[model samples]
Target chain A: MSFELFSNLVGAFFTLCIFSFLYKDNPFYQAAEQMLVGISLGYGLVYTYNRVFVPYVYQTIIIQHQFVLIIPAIMGMLYLLRFSRKLGWLSRYPIAFSMMGVGMGVPMGIHAAILVQMRQAMVPIESFNLFLIFIGTIAVLLYFFFSKAHKGVYGKFVNVGKWYMMIGFGASFGLTVMARISLLIGRIQFLVNDVIGILK
Target chain B: MKKTIPLLIVIVGGLIWVVWAFSPHYVLQEVFYNQFYLPWAYASASFAMLLGVLSLTMMHSNKIKMRAPKWQYSYFFFASFVITCLAGFIGGIQKGGLFMWMFENVQMPMSATMFSLLAFYMASAAYKAFRARSPEATVLLIAAIVVMLAQVPLGVKLSKHLPTISQWILDVPNLASKRGIMLGVGLGSVATSLKILLGIERSYLGGD
Candidate 1:
């Protein structure tokens, strides 16, 4: 067979290997799973080595002799110390450095997620749709409020919030299912057209 | 000394961000952040990815050595990993060759097929679990059906306004409720970060 045909056959085989899981988890599925894990990691390892380690660390510090860049290189090296038993405590330095990034991200998160979201929701209720949306947003917030018991006039608003949340979740579920279905359709198209046409 | 210094690093780093946020000065924005902090974080992420690769390698090797349950699968892992690494390193990943071919044929199809399997399982889940036991459940089911139908031509055929109603459902209630959830999460994130910076949350240091 030609290389293109051979490639299609290999693709068809692995596709079948994965689809076998729909029936039951057999060696075929397990083999494909293992292959996926291994190959993805290998791809990641090589990509990171080339794309990241090369220009960022090796080229900058070693080749260019920008010695200040070695600070993070040394910090990065500290991560490998995690493999050592006695020096495992040193690994915390890298962890802390990583956490610094996370901690610093709080102000950004507050601005984008909370403040901007709140501002976006605070639109003037010019129409029925806007009124519904504004009310729905308020209700959802009230539903999340736990200090007050769900028994009074305010509780009614909370009940409305609960309905809006259910609708939101349902919409999300529907979107995800349809996306997966489209992906399935693409794979089936590949099998029906590409694989079968080559055989013919 | 090891633990204390790391804690201090997080606090001092976080405080710098707080200062940057409030001040908006060029030195903090350009020199300190863009020049120093970003590159350091970028380079560190590479080392982190290397750790993940190493961790997987160690796990598979140990599994094979110990003859763990379904340990034969580990051999497949090693073989594929070695073969892929050899292909990439030897053929050169930057140019189109064996590595690209394997990735296009084996990886793409298998990954897409594997995820597509979820559609079948989701169909099963929707049928078995999504019962309209209460008014809330009924609303959820109706909304789900409407949203799913809106994607295809059949829903439009059934009712001319189905698409409009579906869009309204998404743009109004769905967006609003999602925003509420986002606010809650953002608040929690800020609180957690503050606790971490203040040394109140020592859990990251492998403590209670």
Candidate 2:
């Protein structure tokens, strides 16, 4: 068989292996999962080495004569020392570096998610939908606010908020299933058009 | 010295970004952060990925050595990893190479199939659990049905207005609830970050 056809056949096998899980878990599915994990990790390693390491580390410090780049390079290499027992403690420095980077994003998240979303919700009520949305936003916020007792008028808002949240979750579930169904259709198309040569 | 230095590093390293956010000084923004800190992060991330690969390989190797249950699958992992790495290094990752062929044939189909499998599981779960016994459940069930119908051509044929109503449900109440959740989460994270930066959150430091 030609290489292209052979590739298609192999693809069909893996697809079938995964589809087998729908019926029940079996060795074919397990093997396919393990192989995928290995292959993707391998591919990621090579891609990272070529894409990030080559230019950022190797080319920058070695060829471009940027000596200061060695600081982070050394810090990066500290991860390898994690395998050593005594030197393992040294890995915390790099961990702290990465964690600090995460910490940095807190303000960014506050600005983007909190401030921006709040501003977006505060638009003037030009339409009926806007009126509902404004009340929904306030009600949801009040529902989450646990400082005061959820009694009296606050309790009523909380109920409306709960309804809004339920509807929101249901919509999310529907969209997610639709997305997965589309992916299912894609795999089915490949099997028919590529493997069986029936739908081409 | 080890503990003190790293803790100090955490505080200083964290404060640097916070300073960058508020200050926008030329030195902090263009000089130090862009030129120095960014590359450090990239290099550190690459190493972390390598660390993950190494850890997984070691785990599988140990599993084979111990002859654990389903250990036979470990060999397949090794073979796949070795073969893919060889293909990538020897043939290069350019188009039409062994690496790309393996990825196209083996990886993409399997991954896509794995994700698509969720559709069946979700459908089954919905069938088993989506009983509308209460007023709240009735609202949820109705919303889901409306949205799902709007996703296909059948909905348009069924009612012409189904799609518009679905869109409004998503745009209004759905968005409002999501915004509330995001605001709550953002506030919590900001508090935690401040605690960490100010040295109040010593749980991360661990061991005295």
Candidate 3:
């Protein structure tokens, strides 16, 4: 068969496999799910090795013959010791180091991007909007404040916050719903355009 | 010796790495990235994938030996796994071939299906949630109805104003709520990372 015909056939079969899940769990769906996982893991491994390890370690250590790569290379080898129960404790050195490294790296990276941006977002852009911002901020703060009962002067502020919070939640829920609906629409479009080729 | 030595190394090494990452020196940053961070990520993920493959093989092999009712299904799974892996290995040799085909044909559809399943679930969930038993429920019901109706062409045909209202709802209120969520997520992530860095949350290491 021609390549286009072969691809179209494969696409049709996959669309069927996906739609089969709607009828309840079945062999086809299970196969599709497992295949998906296996392929993703396999692809991810290859990508990581090629894109990261090859250039970083293989070139620097193997080709350039750098002695500094030895330490991390040894650490990498130590990770395989996890297969043994007695020596597994040694493996935690690498795991802990890596986790800590990532833990430290993420915040250091994110602090400037997310935290700073959020603080900026919280600050109102307009003078007239400051009142709304102040009320919204105070009300939201009061809603979370559990140290004292909001029954007196703070009660009104708390009420305002409660209303704003409700509106926020409602809007979030609405967006989430729309997102799901769009997914459904896209699937339906695929079924028509690709699988059955009715739209063509 | 088992716990103390490893914990101490982690504590000292972690601090050093943290300092190394934030330092303004370009050389220190490059050393950390090339020598420590990248290699560590590759080693951990590779080992995890090996464990996953081993588990998959073991599960299927057990089913086949026991003559389970779904033994054929296990065989199919094992065959698919082997085929896909071999395809990827072979395709890697040639730069592009069977692996690309399987990814585009099999994997993408499955991902799309998994995401699409959320639609039916969300619809069912919304149906149950929007019962107008109280004033709050009534308001939610109305809001959901408006949003849902506004999304479709039918709603727009019925009222010229709905699309504008939908845009407003999405842009102003939706943006505000999402920003709030993003802030919460940011704070939570930072808190969790700090806990991990301080070695307070060591559950990720898979031991007491």
Number of the top-ranking candidate, with DockQ as the measure: 1
* Complex DockQ per candidate: 0.77, 0.75, 0.39
Q: Model 3 chain B: which ten-residue window has the lowest total lDDT? A: B172-181
Report how far residue A84 has shifted in candidate 1, in Å. Answer: 3.1
Task: List model 1 lDDT by residue over B1-208, tens digit each.
Answer: 7789999988898788878877779999999888988888767768888778778889988998899999999988888888888998888795468887878888889999989999999989888768888898888888899999999999899998988988988999899889888888888888888888788887887631
Name model 1 segments beyond 4 Å from true.
Answer: none
User: TM-scores of all models?
Assistant: 0.96, 0.95, 0.80
RMSD of each: 1.5, 1.8, 3.9
lDDT of 3 by residue, B26-101 (tens): 6667766665566656544444445455656777788889998767676556666667667766667243488777
Per-residue C-alpha lDDT of model 1 across residues A11-37, encoded as one tens digit per residue:
999999999998898999999999988
Model 2 RMSD in Å is 1.8
Once fitted onto the true fold, the runs of candidate 3 whose alpha carbons sit more than 4 angstroms away are A57-59, A67-74, A77-84, A102-118, A121-134, A149-156, A159-166, A198-200, B17-22, B30-48, B55-72, B93-96, B134-151, B179-185
Query: Which pairs of residues collide in model 2?
Result: none
Better of 2 and 3 by lDDT: 2
lDDT of each: 0.86, 0.86, 0.65
For the candidates in turn, chain A alone yields TM-scores of 0.96, 0.93, 0.76
How far residue B28's Cα lies from its native spot in candidate 2, in Å, is 1.0
Residue A65 accuracy (lDDT) in model 3: 80
